[model samples]
Target: MHGVVLAVLLQATMAGGKHDYNAAFKSADESGKPLLILVGTNWCPGCVTMKRSVMPSLLRKGKLSEVAYAEVDADSQSGLAGKLMQGGSIPQLILYRKTSTGWRRKLLIGAQSEMTVTTLVDRAVEQQAALQAESAEQSVVTASHVEAAE
Candidate 1:
């Protein structure tokens, strides 16, 4: 009975809170993927709306697999939220790209609908592809230059 109660409490606590951004970012780095940060407060209706309506639709339509999704609570992680977003508004969606500058923003601060979210995700994928192509081209150019020098 005691163990059962403890398990329930643990689940409740986790469900009631926001995601761990550091951990999520680490996972995305490991997977060589982008990261999506959804900043929201538990009591914020807009946040809840985005989570339930926009997020699920994107997920269902296979629009969210290329990146990792994480949620930060504005109320709980106010300092982190403030650093990321100027206004500290709920339902702030941020896309991050891993680079020499660390997690740089690809997009910031928008009112998200399902279509808008899908379009944003598609844009992120396109950006990633462009970066990869540029890197490959650079490598090819470097190899050719090295061969000419030899």
Candidate 2:
């Protein structure tokens, strides 16, 4: 089961252009992978650097294989972008992970380096795995207790 989940996450594709928040969210939910959003406008330099340099480099290195990614243009998708932004700069990389209790959000404001982004992704994956493992263990314990009662 763990292998299957990891495989699904690693196999998740990252979309470069023409992004839709709804679609990306749906895909992440269905695939059990975290949703990663890059919010920026074409005019923003930091945004450009993220879209052109950072993201592509990460994708090439297979660092972003475990998450569903989307690029949101703040100019065009202002409504969605405004909602997602936590009062920060142009280039904001937001990650939404579904945990055992609910959704967990992590945000990085401004242009970030490859190492920084990689660390963020790695931490998210690790946290998610830990939460899932704990959940599974609880389920097993609950099942055993119920069986003994029966």
Candidate 3:
């Protein structure tokens, strides 16, 4: 049963895959992966540039081949923007990573090269792995305490 679940999850994190903001967050939680979010509005040229050129180029060059990505419209998702940011900026790449305490964010404002995005995503994934390991260790400790009490 665990093997089947692992296999399915392994298939899900093929990298460079684009999902919606909600899906990206869910995927990160489920697969223990990090999210690469491109925050923008429909009218923002920089956002369009990253979407139509930079990101697509990165995808074509296999730069983002190991991370999950999402393009979010900050203007439309005002509630999300208010919660996540002080300034709603376009073409901002935000990496949302899960930690033992909560979510950690790495923000890159404005347009970035393929390498910049790649490096950030890689770092976020590494951090998330550490967080997950810590959480697993805590769970083990908690379970042992419960067993000892019983």
Candidate 4:
């Protein structure tokens, strides 16, 4: 009973951006959805542009409907921001995709245009689908080989 309540609370808190980052990651993992993280600071002009304009536009277009998205303020979530960032640029976008073997990570630094973000998400989703198909095909082939041996 308590466990179920806690899980419900966690899911409720992870609806979109400006929520608990850890909760968002857990939700994405449990749902098998790709997690999209935007790391930025409030004072940065580029970061402001992304947070205010670019992301909203993508959301409106439904490009992000399939993703679990989170926004991390670099100033407040410095520890998490540091771990996700590869460069010193603000507004770093990170995508975590669950594959057959493990989680795949992709990153884009600096403020990006809507087209760039769309391309990254679309490409990642497409690649994940291809991987799933390949994995399924391998399983079928392995089963056939085992049956033939038997």
lDDT per residue as tens, model 4, 60-104: 899987777888888877988999888778789999999978988
Give the poorly placed runs of model 4, Cα more than 4 Å off.
1-20
> Please, what is the whole-model Cα lDDT of each candidate in the order they appear?
0.76, 0.85, 0.75, 0.85
- What lDDT does model 1 reach? 0.76
Span of ten consecutive residues with least summed lDDT in model 2: 11-20
lDDT of 2 by residue, 1-150 (tens): 999988775553333233557777888888767889999988899999999999989988999888888888888778889999989588999999998677899999999999999999899888777777898899999999999999
What is the C-alpha lDDT profile of model 3 across 69-124, one tens digit per residue? 77766766667666665465667888877666777788888878778877887777
Better of 2 and 4 by TM-score: 2
* Candidate number with greatest TM-score: 2
Better of 1 and 2 by lDDT: 2
Q: How far off is residue 68 in model 3, in Å?
A: 2.9
Using lDDT as the measure, the top candidate is 2
Query: What's the ranking of the predictions by TM-score, best on top?
Result: 2, 1, 4, 3
Taking all chains together, each candidate's TM-score versus the true structure is 0.79, 0.83, 0.69, 0.77
**Residue 65: error of model 1 in Å?**
0.8
Q: What is the lDDT of residue 100 in candidate 2?
A: 66
